[model samples]
Target chain A: MNINLTLIGQSITFAVFVWFCMKFIWPHIVHALDVRRKAIADGLAAAERGKHEQELAAKRATETLHDSKVKAAEIIAQAEKRAVQIIEEAKATAKAEGDRQLAAAQAEIEQAAHRAREQLRSQVAALVLAGAEKVLRREVDAKAHADLLEAISKEI
Target chain B: MAGEAHTSAEYIKHHLQNLVYGQHPDGTWGLAHSAAEAKAMGFWAIHLDTLGMSVLLGVVFLYFFRKAAIRATSGVPGGLQNFVEWVVEFIDGSVKGSFTGRNPLVAPLALTIFIWIFLLNLMDLVPIDWIPGLMGALGLPYFKLVPTTDPNATFGMAIGVFILILYYSVKMKGVGGFFGELAFQPFGKWGMPANLLLEGVNLIAKPVSLALRLFGNLYAGEMIFILIALMFSGGAVMFLTGGVLQWAWAVFHVLIITLQAFIFMTLTIVYLDMAHQEHH
Candidate 1:
């Protein structure tokens, strides 16, 4: 083939194409790729962060559960202590009430025993007077004997 | 195009000749009908076939790419956009690997050279006689479809790269530095003539080899196809053999065309890279 002016025409066409491509085509596509790369990177980073936050929230929930458990144990311990104290106080009140009732009963029984002994002593004195009269075979002065009998009853 | 009356040599010559439009010996402007008349038109004539096919392919290349560029997104890509991006990425990767310079033009120029040359070379697989047969029916004198077969088009592109190489070498390293490189490289100033002779040839050979390698490969490939086509005009046995041989050569030619385009683009990037390197 002979070299001719076609070389220049082809050269002109070649230059125009390269110019058009450089001006219009390359930057947009490259920019799109760059942007897509950045988006993927950002998405991965966000996912990592979200995973970390989820772990933190789970930890916080467990910690709150532990705190509530400890608090519940303390409240139960206090309730058990208050119940024991109330039981002890009731025992003390019952013992005091029993002691007061026993004292009142004992005082009444003593008074009753004293009254019965006085009655028995008075009866015994009367029987001695009657036996002495039988031994003397005569009725003594009754009014003078009464005072002595009363004194003997008091001694008994 | 050759009629059915042409002999084998005439068919081969007809297929090899370009449809040139230029001045005749009478100083009149018209299309050349004969190869001798085309030669007489000399350096002023242009090959209309090469020019038209190249520009058409270039336009097709640009239109599709321009559409892709206009709709390119960081989002999900459509099929056309995906294909366009894939090709652009291939070019970009080659450039990034081969070129360390920060010039924006290198990548796009590489893209243009690769795709445009590949498209031109792809014309070789068009069955050798389709377009010319069509043009023959319409009464055109000559039609060489594959532009890479034309030395003018290959040199056109190669010389364009050569111009850029020369421009950048001078721009990056001042005129004095560039001249000094040619005059002092591979040997000291003591061997200035030898060094200049060596480096100058090295410099000029970049474009020459680039142009010739592509032109030679496709030219030879086209010549083989033309020869096989001549076989079709023989007996039925020759016609079947020609068909099989044509298919085989065309299948193998696909690799050659793609490789030549890749080589051309690679060499261009390398030469431009060399140009942008300062002499340390």
Candidate 2:
């Protein structure tokens, strides 16, 4: 173990190895570690963002569901009001038509009764004139007794 | 069987010696004839085994880690990617805890130091005689496989760290501030000379302790293994006792090697952190 040229050779070798390591090996390893750390951080941040977005979407879906339910209820209430109005209108129309038909029928019945009474009066007058002519055995002077005949007809 | 013709001391001495190449005292540039010859060659000599084994282990470390780096992903990791990420993260945690500076190089430097030293120390666990026996058969007379067991390799790493510490100190505080730090004190400027001596020793102690601590532990561990191997060569009775002892030592040595590597890496980070501090 004398101090010799081997010392110089080993020093040179040590210098070379240290230089190679500083230049090549060390940087790559350190960079890889840093890159991995960054990637993990980014992944964690993305996961947090995704969770927040999911929560927002769920909340929106619940709000939309509630809105649709309210709208459907409003639509159903309006439809019920329209149905009641239509039923009332139909009832009013039917009542008006029945009143008009009843009035017409009553007028027609009164006119028919009046026409039958007139016919009966005229037949009774002719029958009375024929009986008077037969009882008197001659033709009475009808032109001189016009007033009396009118009165007899009125009584009859 | 290799020690069959030699005494225990010779076996241990052979295992401790490195396959060195340098100028001989006879005015020839070649492999050293002996340990004494290798020492005599002085500063010019190279321990081929330490250099070769360390470089090979370093290359292996780089190749696998480079592959893992290429396949690294921001997503979940698997297999080699997982292992690489775990090691990087472990080193990064230690650096983050110990280091206060923002320099990009500290974490990677700590990682390289930890794993590279770990791989170097792991060579000790291999049966002491396996590779040396192989090299012996191939006509190489000596081989010391574990680089950390050699003072040169550990000191080499420590010196490199020391240079970086000095560079950072100068870069952060300028040359005057750097020297001021080395000269100023646990006492005031009135005690400048004492402060200089004390702080100077403190400054020098960082690298010295870093280097020696690792080298001492691993060298001692390697010596013990050599002793155990010597025991194995004694006889059948010694072989059984040696086998049990080697296994127990190796099991315990695992913690030592890992702890030494951790201590080395942590100290480096702490020293660099201290360099970055404006006042400490």
Candidate 3:
């Protein structure tokens, strides 16, 4: 169509479009973009913080592990010390018991020896008296017999 | 135009020109077109075009950020709250570097300007004929959906920025100061006649360049698409070949649109910065 009126309308319409865009429309889109940018930066910051936290946690875990190992070592050392003390105490007690047993055995041996010796001496004396009784006759004169016996005994 | 092909090109170009004021008898442009109609329509939908998308996106962001911002704590941040803060800070940095003084209104305004323009520019990535063809199939005759492709739209924005720069210049540097800048800044102190001529040219060039940059890029993009369409409309062989070419170009065009939007936003900052500078 050869209509110029449409062109006129279009020109007016376009100018208004520009005005609307500059005044109102542009700000909103910019705000959205601005939001996008901020989101990216925040994400980076959060990631950094997370990394730091993780590093800290790892450090704490290592320290705790080291502490536990040291404590275990200390406990083992203490047990070893206690074991040595117990062994020393047991050794002392055994030595003392052996000494007491040796003393008791010696005392029993001495008593037995004394009893045997006495019995032997008694037996000997009885035998000698019996021999004298057999040799002498009954109802003899005591003084005469005694003097004879003494003289014979001195000569032999 | 002897060839049918040449006639078609002419036809398309004719159709693409703005419906400014009134036309000549032979469908050429008249000397004095109505500025009132041009002023009114040029700024209307262009404003709505940017505003509509901005508000929608803003509401979505606000809803999401509100939830995030509320949940924010000094302890640890995750999910959406972290995301929102990241975006806010990034844009804050960009604005800080580009804009000198902290005007509460200007920062947010610049942010809006960037994103809205970005979204608008992104629309170019869609297949040139896709929406129009779909609408046609749905019984709608024609659709010129791209906002930036319209010169009126780009110029309108440029003009708006131009006005603001002028206002700020006047405010920052008084009337004498504003005039003094054009007279002596570009060239050293010369006679009044030469100074006046140079100043007038410099003064007019700002809005012209701003408007033309956006217009030229978008217009060129639109023309390429129209050319591709013409190829397909001719025959089946041309259609298939042109279709492949169109797809390839569309993919490549994504970078163009994004770059254009970024350039426009950055330029806006630069221009505003210039206005704020103290004259030597």
Q: True contacts preserved, each candidate?
A: 0.93, 0.80, 0.02
Model 2: per-residue Cα lDDT over A63-144, one tens digit each: 9999999999999999999999999999998888888888888888888888888888878787896677576445666776
Write down the lDDT of every candidate, Cα atoms only: 0.92, 0.90, 0.61
Model 2 lDDT at residue B3? 60
Model 1 scores a C-alpha lDDT of: 0.92
Each model's iRMS: 0.7, 0.9, 9.4
For model 2 the TM-score comes to 0.86
Regions of candidate 3 where Cα sits further than 4 Å from its true position: A1-96, A115-156, B1-14, B17-150, B170-180, B183-200, B217-260
DockQ of 2: 0.68
TM-score of chain A of 3: 0.54
Residue range B111-166, candidate 2, lDDT tens digits: 99999999999999999889998988898889999999999899999999999999
Candidate 1 Cα outliers beyond 4 Å, as residue runs: A63-156
Which candidate number would show the highest lDDT if scored against the true structure? 1
Deviation of model 1 at A88, angstroms: 5.3
| lDDT of each residue in B136-190, candidate 3, tens digit only | 4775333445656665556656666677779888888898888888777565676
List the DockQ of the predictions in order.
Answer: 0.66, 0.68, 0.04
TM-scores of all candidate predictions against the true structure: 0.84, 0.86, 0.54
Order of candidate numbers by lDDT, starting with the best: 1, 2, 3
Interface RMS deviation of candidate 2: 0.9
Q: What share of the true interface contacts does candidate 3 keep?
A: 0.02
The best candidate in terms of DockQ = 2
